[model samples]
Target: MKHLKEVDAVTTELREALAGAGVVLPSLRPDPVSIAHRYNPPLVELGRCSMEVARRLTAALTPTRQSRGERP
Candidate 1:
């Protein structure tokens, strides 16, 4: 039960973080297999998104020139 809660918290955190970056993973959630009380640690399912969303996620993950202290 504790593990499940923790995993859920993680999922929520990730969702909020991604939203902050303008990235919304529609199917984001905890992996059922991993959260079946069979594993100590749970896995997060990012699910699939459109190419546009994927590109946006990649851009968010990547540091831009300005973010790296360089002029664009």
Candidate 2:
């Protein structure tokens, strides 16, 4: 719980820092597998959320934006 909050806080900060650069990262949401227990996600579920965010971030980077059909 504490760890997740920490991650969320840092993520929000990063999101703000990059927003001006046109790199809008997705906000982290509760993992679908653990939505019913939003406050207590298991380690594996947290990992899944992290991976999803990573995938989104990677796709948002300049090199991949053009491939995704957006002007880079």
Candidate 3:
């Protein structure tokens, strides 16, 4: 709960930016591994953020032509 607000804010911003750029990312859901057992909420959130961060970083590092809706 401590970082809920921060995480939600970040996720929302990421979603909006991606949407604006015509990029659609899959929603983050409880992992199947977590369903089979118990998992911490903070860690789950961290995982989602990790995924989003990696996605954004990858996109940012990609060539400008590819990122700008141009043929590579």
Candidate 4:
């Protein structure tokens, strides 16, 4: 739990980012095992979402005219 706060902060930030893109990760959390060890940095587990969520996420991540402040 060394980086507990840091992990939570990052997880929350990601949630907000996803929210801005109309995405929701129902089971977002910090991986306990990852933080427990000292070998690697803590990991934020996005957990699971539906196909629609996947598609939306992909769309948000992908470049589009709207994202670039362009008009159709």
Candidate 5:
């Protein structure tokens, strides 16, 4: 139907937007270990640390939102 087509179009647009934003959706055939091995452990560690800090900051900010009675 026309609605189905519209829904598909919207989904495709959302996927493209997420890809542009550097988010890769689940893929059935991910590249193997050889590619992963090329990544430097230090760089990976830095990214992990940065993500942890961001998560902690977000968690810390949530209390302020709660004090203001924000929904989340």
Candidate 6:
């Protein structure tokens, strides 16, 4: 729980910095298979990074949701 809170704090700070830079972060939603199929190197790199973060967040949150009897 402490680690989660620390990670959240770091994420918040990073987001604020990005916002101050006028950089709009893209959605981290998993790309549809059709869309992912069209990516070249740069897009692929971005997609991979987003996917990794999304996966880690999902994994961390899932158990907490289950503990609360929530259907995610």
Find the candidate with the highest TM-score and give its number.
Answer: 1
**Candidate 3 ranges with C-alpha deviation above 4 Å:** 29-61, 65-72
lDDT by residue (1-72, candidate 6, tens digit) is 343444455556655654565443454222234333433311211223365556654565456766999888
Q: Rank by TM-score, descending?
A: 1, 4, 3, 6, 5, 2
In angstroms, the error of model 2 at 13 is 0.6
Q: What TM-score fits each model?
A: 0.90, 0.35, 0.42, 0.81, 0.36, 0.36
lDDT of 4 by residue, 1-72 (tens): 558889999999999999999999899999888988787889999898999999999998999998789998
Each model's lDDT comes to 0.93, 0.52, 0.54, 0.91, 0.43, 0.45
Better of 1 and 4 by TM-score: 1
Q: Write candidate 3's Cα lDDT for 1-72 as tens digits.
A: 445554556667766776676555565433444334434433222233456666775775577886679997
Which segments of candidate 2 are over 4 A away from where they belong? Answer: 27-72
State in Å the error of residue 44, model 6: 18
Model 6 residue 54 distance off true place after TM-score fit, in angstroms: 18
Pairs of colliding residues, candidate 5: none
lDDT tens readout by residue for model 5, 20-43: 655434431222332244342211
Residue 55, candidate 4: how far off, in angstroms? 0.7
Q: What would you estimate as the lDDT of candidate 2?
A: 0.52
Report how far off residue 13 is in candidate 3 (Å). 0.5
Worst ten in a row by lDDT for model 6: 39-48
Candidate number that wins on lDDT, 2 or 5: 2
The Cα error of candidate 5 at residue 26, in Å, is 2.3
Quote the positional error of residue 2 for candidate 5 in Å. 0.8
> What RMSD does model 5 have?
13.1
